[model samples]
Target: MADAVALRQALAAFLGDTQYRKFVARGMYRGRMAYWQEQEWTRFTTAHPEFAVDLNELAAALLVCHLHGDELKPDTAEVFHGCMDLARWYVEARSRLFPYAAQDVISTEGRPFEGDRIGVLFCPACRVARAGWRRR
Candidate 1:
């Protein structure tokens, strides 16, 4: 139920923490930063049950943001905005029973790449929903 602002703030805080930076560094060195273990995700979800949806959405947004690059560019910024909007819609609509509803609504896949670097891994649903935002 958390909003995009809260999700962004939480993600920033989590990523800014020294421990997390070190964790990322270690993962990078081990070539494991591109993926997460199921248990690790479970622990994160267990610790922050309230932000689960937001966290998932934020992860997807960050990946898309990385993909677009140059956040200052108008087109890239639009992509970020569109991705966030799509994520909010996905969260709101996920509980309804309907025909042609999106499947695999949360991304469980490994991190998406930006050039040679590993970006954040996002849910499959968000990725699908944001496809339109990508530049031709």
Candidate 2:
């Protein structure tokens, strides 16, 4: 098994990668109008096989996060939970092969809101992952 710390770092790197960012941005924009080309997904999967599952989950989570904001509606909670589960798995696995990193620092910027057990409602990891997905 890969080291949890390394896996987290690698995930962070992948989330920060410029090409990955562009791919995700494109997916988010174009994805709404039509399905992504099989070739595009194939190219991405070929380039980052280790992240195939993660990317798929992230894409789903991003759509949910975008449509619903921090509020995880019942219909979208499954996707959100899936991303969180994947994050937990990666953290536990400690994989260490993160080759992609953003040329510039990736920021996790957002406004704060008040709520009971806000952390549970709007997880930091979820927010950062969403930001990475939305980043251009």
Candidate 3:
């Protein structure tokens, strides 16, 4: 319902500083500087109940951004094994991080294709939280 940034900040608060920093330290994010508060995040997610059901990729990006400071992109991100297949498409054929379909379609990460919802395919081989130039 809200924008990507909103989802990310709320996720950061929900995750907490230490855990949130992990994604950032790993170069999972692109570049960014922002602020957040757990209390506000609590309120937002609560109001948006669907958010409670799913939030893996966004959470990952939030952590990377807050810790690193930049937008969310692959080049700025730390590479992972076999991730190039997914990343090289550069955001699903460069069509945006999550693109929706007109009709009903199945998706992963607990986020069903419900009304303008976006989906992503994480490294199927590995969760690879530490995406840091593994493919040098």
Candidate 4:
């Protein structure tokens, strides 16, 4: 069975089911929407019960498709990590710029959120990067 122990251990060079599932969740709050899939949402939520990310296009497309070509690119891991870095800035900036009145305030509006247009994320692809722009 692929568990925490198995995931920490990297015997194979290829991206395994366990690893891919985790990656789905990581880019989730960060970026790498191009790699996300609806099916993987379950695994992501299960693996990271502590996180309370909403399953929305905005969260999914937090980062633009900075990546090009194959899903299993040699530097794919780095790209995922890159999202992790952006996540921090996102939180801080959101607080100052968006300044959610409440935790749920972030949800009041939808993607293409009314914030600064900075490509702090991967590609500023989604509605932000996903949409080819960036949220504050």
How many residue pairs clash in all the candidates, one count each? 2, 3, 6, 12
Segments in model 1 whose C-alpha atoms lie over 4 Å from true places: 15-33, 37-40, 54-56, 63-136
Candidate 4 positional error at 125, Å: 12
Q: Write the per-residue lDDT of candidate 3 for residues 15-121, one digit (tens) a residue.
A: 66675554343432233223343344456568776565233454554433333334544321222222123345534422332221111122333433334343333
lDDT of 4 by residue, 86-128 (tens): 3677667544433211211123123344443222322211223
Which regions of candidate 3 deviate over 4 angstroms?
23-66, 74-136
- Point out the higher-scoring one by lDDT: 3 or 4: 3
Whole-model lDDT values for every prediction:
0.37, 0.36, 0.40, 0.33
Q: For residues 30-78, what per-residue lDDT tens digits would candidate 1 score against the true structure?
A: 3233445334445555766766664355343333222222111111111
**RMSD, candidate 1, Å:** 16.7
Query: Alpha carbon lDDT of residue 54, candidate 1?
Result: 41
Better of 1 and 4 by TM-score: 1
Candidate achieving higher lDDT, 1 or 2: 1
Off by over 4 Å in 2: 1-17, 29-40, 54-56, 61-136
RMSD of each: 16.7, 15.6, 14.4, 16.0
Model 3: residue 25 alpha-carbon error in angstroms: 5.2
Supply candidate 3's per-residue lDDT for 63: 32
